[model samples]
Target: MSAVTPLLAAEELSFAYGPGQPVLREVSLAVAPGESLGLVGESGAGKTSLLRLLLGLSAPTGGRVVFEGHALDRRSAATMRKFRQAVQPVYQDPFSSLDPRMTVGESIAEPLRSLRVTGDRAARAARVAELLTAVDLPADAATRYPDAFSGGQRQRIAIARALAPKPRLILADEPLSALDTSVRMHVIELFQRLAREQGIGMLLVSHDLTIVSALCGRMAVLESGRIVEEGPTGQLLTEPQHPYTRRLLASVPRLPG
Candidate 1:
């Protein structure tokens, strides 16, 4: 079998703002088809900055982002359009991520409109219903507004929206942080199921080690914009090498011996 090209990759990426010190220095990572990677770090570790660079929201001062073997060239509208179509993002705050005025169905279908997907009104509505069902939301939920649902339900809507584009890869930033602790695991499970069933790759960014360990097979630990350690989730959690990585693992509470 031929080697499967990576869905997304950041090669020796470096980014900085103004004249300040670089936020990300020589950082690199890759997300392959059907792969899920967890990006973990404390605040100010430059995780967000790195995500933006990967998403092509901002160009890096050095290095490059490659998607599907092609270097991202925002200068070309075609490159950007194709990149946007292939990559989707799910933000942490579902409520804010969703438009208040647009109905849930409209919000989910917005991507279809942006991508100029072909379909009549009825067909689009049917697609919206299908997506809602996929996320375990009732079809009628689509007629309601974002405020009509609980935090968890709103997040489900967000995930449905991310899935709308039929993206090759999903970049989720702190997806469960804004959710209730009880609902976090449920959402994480939903992510895993959706990614697996859809055969889509995921880059999940979060500080919760337990959640990452549960949801992702592989993980990368970031400290001050650099990847300090990376490996299979199980090995990294049990036997981390870097002091920063060990400290992160230490923060996770454990049962009495």
Candidate 2:
């Protein structure tokens, strides 16, 4: 873990809307190669805002975002395109993230077409099927429209779309929060498998400590846009230093004795 370089990094990131309401201030974190770093916090703790800033979708008020040791900017069009392809984001609301007008297959293929990845439509369709199978979904799913799928299925489709570009870094913002327990377990397992097998670095933004503990090697707890505590998952869960961390953990339901 100490040997590899970071796949994604942010230094002293600050962002805000209008003149007031600063969402993030000096928030810094790094995700190592092929590693999973969970970002957990209560709602409005600036989790989603930070992700947008990292992806270059929203400019930081005052800080830099670096990916694969390269600062993210449009200085070179080709370089910026490569950075876009390298980093992909999966939003929490699949229903909204996906284009309702497009079929499942079309939605998945959009990335390849937009990126000009240089592949025939037939070949891309075939690859999409393979990805669906990898995610434990049916091939026929690609033929259906997004409206036909359930919440879990929609999330699966969204994940498949993100994987189409073969991104090195994936930022999943609460990808499994909407699903039932059974479906959430399946999605979490899929995420873990992808991290291990595909060598993909994932920045999973979630408020669920149990989910983070299951998937992330290390994590940071955010409070009012500040990382109050951060360490190995096991260490922090067993013995957290910050009061907010302990309070967050206590909020999770526990079984009877």
Candidate 3:
């Protein structure tokens, strides 16, 4: 671990649906301020379960999630409100993540209102426009509904919404999985630029090693809800020590040279 305190961390975290059905066990990892960490695993590997735990959407059965050195206390509305402001989530499936009835601007400004950010209606509108530009969406697009946008555009809108709070950390769960292959790289670049320019920490959970390789400096390989391996992204990809990690890397499609 870095000497600097983590922006978010899962320590010996575990989860389950019932007595015999374990979803995750003994998982531990951290994302430092302005750093990006990737959690890669196959479906049913408990990746989403872990994300839920980190987001405080679900309580873990064992251990705890720490944010800036303090354990998360969901019952404390004041504390959780602060936590929500600092940490935001961008989920999978941009198609369903957004509300069809609300205009793009309203959706983006929702966080600002819900978080009680210090901004009036006009300020929020300006912030929304700024965010739309940051995400490469036209400012005028804000008046349109989700149905007017393509899958990639919707995802960009989702990203803008996540950024509205000026969050310190972003918990992105398979953020690019729903995009077209041709546009995936563009979104990947967008994520990289946002992380670099805004100094925001990210915990990206995905099944795609390629996406993780593109955005994450450090990565943790999760298998069956456990962290099988973790290290610098380059090192883990080139010299995977765990069989599961190696298998995952091997599965990535490569161009014949």
Candidate 4:
């Protein structure tokens, strides 16, 4: 564990669809300030369920989600609002994540308006432009709608929107999965730069170990709702102790040396 206080943490988090249908079991993980952590698992391994719980979209059957030092209180609007501002989310599908009806500028600025950020229209506009630039999008692109851009560009716009609130942490759920292979590395580089230069932490959830290795310093392998192994990304890739983790590593394609 990092010596610095964790920005977000799940303590013994467990969830279930019904009395006997448990989706998660005693899951614990932490993302420290400016740290990038990855959660790796197969389909139906409860990764999305855990994310929903962390995002406060769903209440956990057991355990709790903690931010900074305080336990999350879904009942408290103030707490949730503050949490929302500090921790933003970048979901997998950029095509569906963005609103086709809204202009790109409006979409990016929505958080500032909804979060009640203390800024007038001009200030907000400037912030939006700044974010667009940060994500390598042209200032003029903001005038267009989501459909005007390609998949990669749309993902950049989604990233810009996530940055509008100046979040301390970003929860990325399979952020690169929907992109073409040609663009995946670009997005990965963008994520690396954002975390390095902006001091933003991240919790990246993906089934692809290759993507996880590229972006995360540490990783946890989930199997059947349990974290079977975890460690530094390099160590986990080179010397996975669990059978599930080894199998996962073996599944990754490698080119001839």
RMSD to native for every prediction?
A: 1.3, 1.7, 1.3, 1.4
Clashes of 2: 0
Compared with the true structure, all predictions reach lDDT values of: 0.90, 0.87, 0.93, 0.92
Instruction: Indicate the TM-score of model 1.
Output: 0.96
Tens digit per residue, CA lDDT, model 3, 1-257: 74899889999999999999999998999899998999999999999999999999999999999988999999999889899999999999999999999999999999999989846999999999999999899989989999999999999999999899899999999999888998898898899899888988899999988888899999999999899999999999999999999899888888999
Candidate 3 overall lDDT versus native:
0.93
Give candidate 4 misplaced runs (Cα > 4 Å): none
Better of 2 and 4 by TM-score: 4
**How many residue pairs clash (N, CA or C atoms closer than 3 angstroms) in each of the candidate models, in the order given?**
0, 0, 0, 0
lDDT of 2 by residue, 205-245 (tens): 99998899988999988888888888898999999999999
User: What's the TM-score of each model vs. the native?
Assistant: 0.96, 0.95, 0.97, 0.97
Tens-digit lDDT string for candidate 4 (5-77):
7889999999999989999999999888888899999999999899989999999888999999789999999
Q: After superposition, how far is residue 38 of candidate 1 from its true place, in Å?
A: 0.5
As a TM-score, model 2 comes out at 0.95
Given candidate 1, what's the lDDT at residue 192?
Answer: 80
- Local accuracy of candidate 1 as per-residue lDDT tens digits, 78-102: 7887888789998889879999999
In candidate 2, how many Å is residue 146 off?
0.9
